[model samples]
Target: MLEVTGLHVAYGGIQAVRSITFHVNEGETVALIGANGAGKTTTLKAISRVVNAVGGDVHFCGEKIIGVAPHEIIRKGIALVPEGRGVFPRLSVLENLRMGAFVRDDKAGIAADIDRMYAYFPRLKERADQLAGTLSGGEQQMLAIGRALMSRPKMLLLDEPSMGLAPIMVQKIFEVIRNVAAAGMTILLIEQNAKLALESSQRAYVMESGEITLNGESAALLHDPKVKAAYLGE
Candidate 1:
């Protein structure tokens, strides 16, 4: 449901992404796996219009989104759960979730989605009145994902969702990701944890030095010798 072609992103004179191309079909979980400085995050930011693309085309549901404003992009059914779990620290968990539906006007639908979020994340429900900054790392990550889902997006862009959590928390997070994909959520994931990304996604792309180096089925890439050596540390 999303397509990015010949994407080139830069900041001033420094180019962060170069001629990158990829796509995520309807109901598919696609992963962009790479090390630090590999432009994985930049590609997602470019697609979401969080950063401008110097050259390229980003189309979502057949509509061009490269020039669209970030808020407009969210309204168009794409929501990004950025790297580092950017939560509103001072706001209560409930308040932060309510903010996710800020672009909508349907009170009943928004309230229903909030209930769904609470169901999806019971910990969030328990801490509804607690300040977001006071939650644990795993709890905060859950809050972030729950908040994004409140927007009722057709496609979700998750950047390093497994970052900074304990191993058990990571597993729990991936289980939620698997359930989301199973329920037909179109997801484009940027993950430094190649193993988790490949395990959770149907298809995967490897990026290096700001360009796509390999793209294929996640299982095949999982066993590929080169991918194993470079990213999986096999």
Candidate 2:
């Protein structure tokens, strides 16, 4: 449902992302896996319009979004759960979740969605009144994902959902991710955790030095020697 073609992004004379082309089919998860500085996050930023693309185009649901304003992105049915789990520190968990549906006016639907989020992450319901900044890393990650889903997005952009968390916590987060994907959420995941990314996604792309180095079925890439050596560490 999303297509990025010849995408290029440069900042401060450093090319963060080179011309890269990829697509995410509707209702499938596509992972972009790489190490630090691989331009994984930049590619998401460009697609989400958080950062400008110097060249190429981003089409979501067949409409160009490259020149679209950042605030307008949510209205187009795309939500980005950015890296580092950007949450409203000063706001309570409940307040933060309410903010997610800021673009909408349907109170009944928003209320129902809040209950749905609480069901998705029961911990969020427990910490309903707690300040977001005080939640643990995993909790904040859950909050981020829940908040994004409040918009009822057609596609979700996830950047490093596994970063800075305990192994058990990562497992918990991925469980939720699996649930979301199973329910037919279209996800374009950018992850430093290659193994998790591959296992979670249906198709995968290996990015290196700001370009796509390999692309194929996730299961095949899991067994590919080059992918194993460079990313899987096998």
Candidate 3:
């Protein structure tokens, strides 16, 4: 449902993402994995229109979205849960969730979706009135994913969902991701945890120094000697 072709993004004179191409099919989870400076995040930003692409096109549901405004992208059936779990620190958890549904006007549906999010992450319901900033890192990550789901997007873009969490917390987060994918959410996940990324996704791409170097079925990549050596530490 999402297609990125020959995407290029450069910061002044420095190129962060070269001409990279990949895609996520409907109801599929595709992972982009690589080292810290491999341009995985930049590729996501370009698709989300948070950063302008210097070349190539991004088509979502068959419409070109490379020119879509950052704010408007959310309305076009795409939601991004950024790397840092960008939550509204000053707002309470409930209020933060409310902000997520600002794009929609279905009061009853919005209320129901909020309840569903709470179900997805009961910790959020427990902190309904707590300030978002004060939550633990894991809680914030949960909040970020919940908030993004409020938009009811056809596709979810996740960036570094395991960046700073403990192992148990990561497990909890991926559990929800598995549930979401099972529920038919098309997800484009950028994860630093290569093992988890490959294991969670059905298909995968490996990036190095701003280019795609390898890609295949996630299960197949898991046993690839190069992938094992470079990403799995095996």
Which residue segments of model 1 deviate by more than 4 Å? none
Pairs clashing within candidate 3: none
lDDT-wise, the better of 1 and 3 is: 3
Q: Using lDDT, give the best candidate's number.
A: 3
Clashes of each: 0, 0, 0
Q: What's the TM-score of each model vs. the native?
A: 0.97, 0.98, 0.99
Candidate 3 versus the native: TM-score?
A: 0.99
lDDT of 3 by residue, 1-234 (tens): 999999999999989999999989999999999999999989999999989999999999999999988998999999999999999999999999989999999999999999999999999999999999999999999999999999999999999999899999999999999999999999999998999999999999999999999999999999999999999999
Please give the lDDT score for candidate 1: 0.92
Name the candidate that leads on TM-score.
3
Lowest lDDT 10-mer window, candidate 1? 114-123
Superposition error at 216 for model 1 (Å): 0.2
Candidate closer to the true structure by TM-score (higher is better), 1 or 3? 3
**lDDT of each candidate versus the true structure:** 0.92, 0.95, 0.95
- Tally clashes: model 1: 0
